[model samples]
Target: MTPTPIAEPLFRPEDAVPMSTDEADVLAWPVAAEQLATLAKYWLATGRASGRPHVMPVMGVWLGSTLTVSSRPGTVKGRNLLRDGRCVVTATTELGDLVLEGDAGRVTDVARQREAAAAFVAKYDWRFGLRDGRAYDDSLPGSPEYAFFEIVPVKGFGYGPDGLTATRWRF
Candidate 1:
């Protein structure tokens, strides 16, 4: 007896419309509430100097439309972003999956970096020994390892068992 081959899923590009700011507002809500909670488990993808792809799990925070990731300056991921300035991040939840494609840039603005750090602290407060105690202070400016990278997503996709939808935001 011969084994039957399983059929592959077919994706149609025309079936979906490009995402708009209004659409982004709708899709971003669940990501803010559920997806951001498990963001640390997601891998951040960056291009290697040799033109290959590298991915590593990282802790991150989603502030409004910006996705911020903190890491040490000497890390490979950091170096890659600084060199190439491009990346893609995916966050999955039981509800669905969120994928962001954008350029990666350092947040040199002290005020913006501090804001990102504050959001990080709020999201992972329990993980940093604040389950029932005082919150961790991430706003300190002296730690070089606390460098922040902002992902300004130009396009986003939300997928589920039902289907996949894409959105493009202006700035």
Candidate 2:
């Protein structure tokens, strides 16, 4: 699937910083996307019904415009996503920190599952076996089942190095 085009993001430098005015210092969208696509680890944050927050490191694949993550339905992150789709996925890159705020919905299509599985294997060298639109770690014992959640970010933030520039994109 093709990524959806977006308007230019709002660039705001914190505390009236002078660096943000330079167009050369502006963080581009492709650079942020590349960092996310190649990132090995990401943090998934979810909120419980009681307003408690849960954060965990998760394996994910950045494909097209969406980020796909897997978790067992019994897990906190999984149950949270199932109950409420709002969540944040974050990662730290060499350039800066990236935050993707969006609603994550469970993916039940087998074809998309296969595509995500292939991307995971290609990126992480981890193979996923699919069954009934879900995936299991192919190399693990007991073959723990995992449900996939895809987040098409409604907004994203990129913090440039050393508190220089803060870029926010609305999609």
Candidate 3:
């Protein structure tokens, strides 16, 4: 889709050139369904209450425009998400890079949780539990409870490796 931004948050580092829809589509981004489906990992960046940055690689599944990820609540990453909803998730490969900037919230709906669980299993070859959708103990015995989160990008960028080109999408 040609980016008709719903909202444009400050995207990119200080030096990147602004992207336009009419230019060549070097990297088909804001992320298409096909690209999202196959991605093995995404880098998630969150903020602590003190405004410190917490970044880690996370297993995620893109369902429609929302990206779902999970972590055990006690971890730093989990705590960060809980305290602050804003985050940035980036995925890259030989094809290009996709950076999603938005606020992430806990997944509370059971149906959506189940859907996310299915997608998680399909993508990661791992299972958490059928006991619940949002958060649950590890599928294995005595595993710690894990929390789920969803991020719908308010602003994002898909760009080529070279500094000269990019496509920005906002929603």
Candidate 4:
């Protein structure tokens, strides 16, 4: 898949805020991507059909322009994503906070699943084996199968630690 092109970061600092107007103060796209790739835990928020919201800490990997996460289809988060693909994924980094607003869909491609699994092992040292086009964690008891979901972010926001620079990135 061709990676999505990210637009130049739009620095939109709050008025009267003590942030530097210099472009240097703005969070760079590469910095955000690096943070997303290295962050250990990310929070995923999904909405139920009835309008209830569910948020959970998930282990995921940022691959190219997509964030890949996994869960059992029977789980609440899984069910919610399967039922309603729209969701938000947020992460906190040492330099800034990141929010990803996108839609997630089930990932059934075996090659992509393998790629995601490799990223998991590289970043988190968690091993996942492929079985019938899905990923299963062999370390856990029963070697539970997981359904992978790929989130293609439509928009993203990055806020600097200093109360100064906020950046909006379009996909």
* Top of the candidates by TM-score: 2
Candidate 3 structure quality by residue, lDDT tens digits, 111-151: 88888888887878677674645466576678768878888
Off by over 4 Å in 4: 1-24
| Model 4, position 118: C-alpha lDDT score | 86
Per-model TM-score, in order, reads 0.65, 0.88, 0.80, 0.86
**What digit string (tens of lDDT, one per residue) describes model 1 on residues 1-171?**
222222121223454344222342344444433565555666789999999998998888876666788766568898999898789988886656766678888877766766775777687762221212222333455423445788877655555534444333233
User: Tens digit of lDDT per residue, candidate 2, span 1-171?
Assistant: 655435343454454445465556556777888888888899999999899999999989987889999888999899999999999998999989988899999988898998888888898888888876668986888999888899989888888877867677677
lDDT tens string, model 4, 7-63? 444543555246455665556677788878887899999998889999999999888
Better of 1 and 3 by TM-score: 3
Model 4 / residue 141 / CA error / Å: 2.6
Q: Model-by-model lDDT, in order?
A: 0.62, 0.84, 0.73, 0.84
What ranges in model 2 sit over 4 Å off?
1-24
lDDT of model number 4: 0.84
Residue pairs with clashing backbones, model 1? 19-167
Best-to-worst order by TM-score is 2, 4, 3, 1
Question: After TM-score superposition, what is the CA distance of residue 124 in candidate 1 from its true location, in Å?
Answer: 1.2
